[model samples]
Target: MINSNIGWEISKNEFYSENAFSKIFDAVVHRTIINVMAIYKKHIRQIRHFIVCSMGILLLASSCSILPFGEVLFSNSESVSTQPTGTIFYDDFSSTTSGWDRSETDLGGADYMDGSYHILIDEKNTDYFSTLYRNYSDIGLQVDARRIDGPYDNNFGLICRYQDEKNFYAGMISSDGYFGIFKIENGEYKILGHDTMVFSELISAGDTGNRIKLDCYQDFLFLYVNDSLLDVQQDKTFGSGDVGLIAGSFEVSGVHIMFDNFYLTDITQTMNQEKQQ
Candidate 1:
């Protein structure tokens, strides 16, 4: 009976030892799995942070490209001109170094010159100018201009009473050439007047300079190129406001044009009242 009891106790002890070993092995495996899961979670968090940072950098770069880099000048009420009894709108091309806004057809793919705010149009594409005014009525407008470079068709003029891209009045002078006044109605250029006294041709192919003057009063329109009188046409088609610059293509080289002196006055008033003394 004592031996049997001793054998039973040994059997019980061996069973308990195996059970304890199995429990310890299970605990080790569970702990290793938990540690590996924690490491994987940490790696995922790092990847997420990297992806977010990359997205932020891309967004910042895109924003910088879309916005314009320059200063814009709005209307200055204090800078109003009192002379010529009119207002002068001047853009010295200081702030707006990038050309003004206009149509592609009118712009004609002109290139920008370095260190200057003027658009350079070559003979290949001379029909490019800034559209200054549109849709205005009943005022005498004058512009002060200086010639920079000539040769080709350095003819600078005004587009008046413009109804669209096709219809308007044009008064222009060629460098060392004659003055021309024409009306464009229904997409046709009709000559109103031409004076060769100042210049033999519409555009002088030399380096001589010229000044042009235009006056629109009631139904009477007068144009002067240099010292020669070009046209005195009467037309009631256009009644008022806004003027623009005119340019054309024909072996035309680029020009540096500066417009400063502006005189606009109400001509309906008496001569004594309109005259500036």
Candidate 2:
């Protein structure tokens, strides 16, 4: 009996040891699997990060290639000088009597009055006015005008770097409809783009007047109306020259107009330097 009991006890001890060894082996395998999964998850995250960064870089490079550098156009390096080099191409009726010349077209009943200018348009009379400024670059041109008489289709705007009456860059707003940037290529003013608000309306002479601002840089042009940005364009055709104003035709009767606050500058270098600071 004693021998049998001792044998039974030894057998139990051996079975328990084998079970403990099996459990330990399974635990080690499970820990190894967990460690491997963690490594795989870390690798996946790294790969995703790399892909996203690559895409961002490519997108940025593409954008840079398409759009002109803002710094080059609106740089702070250029300085605004008090001494004006560019002439005030024209004004309705100025107190200084500087570089403006007054001339009349076949259009009758056109005259200057109340510190403003007026032009009459008819079948026989198609009134037109023009002026020229010399030796100016990089300037902002502004004019305030209102239609006091005539149909809604009366037309007026500023012409910059004008090679002639028909060959130049014209920023015009029509009382009839449409305001846009235009270029006179072969004696015809080609409409580049038109503002939706102005385009949808049927503007006529003696309609509402608006403030127009034109900024010309090296290869860039911007137009603003009523202190708001209306349009921007890139043209290397005419960079620096004279500026002028136009009023006439395309409408029955005529319209009265006024202009003021004419300014010009060559602060291209000064504007660029200021940007860095």
Estimate the TM-score of every prediction. Answer: 0.52, 0.56
Query: Per-residue lDDT tens digits of candidate 2, residues 1-277?
Result: 0111111111231111111222111111111100000001101210000000111112211210121111221112222223333434335353424444343322322333334444334321132444445645676676665555556555567767766443567676766554667665433334454312245333323445566767777777787777677778888877666676655444255454444444554546545666788
Q: Which stretches of candidate 1 lie over 4 Å from their true place?
A: 1-83, 88-119, 123-126, 150-152, 194-209, 226-229, 251-258, 269-277
Residue pairs with backbone atoms closer than 3 Å in model 1 (clashes): 136-240, 136-241, 137-240, 137-241, 138-240, 177-199
Residues forming the 10-long window of minimal summed lDDT in candidate 1: 33-42
RMSD of candidates 1 onward, in order: 32.9, 32.7
Per-model lDDT: 0.40, 0.44
Q: Would you give me the overall lDDT of model 1?
A: 0.40
Number of colliding residue pairs in each model:
6, 29
Q: Write the per-residue lDDT of candidate 1 for residues 175-216, one digit (tens) a residue.
A: 546456666553334456431223454333354434455666
- The number of residue pairs in model 2 that clash at the backbone is 29
lDDT, model 2: 0.44
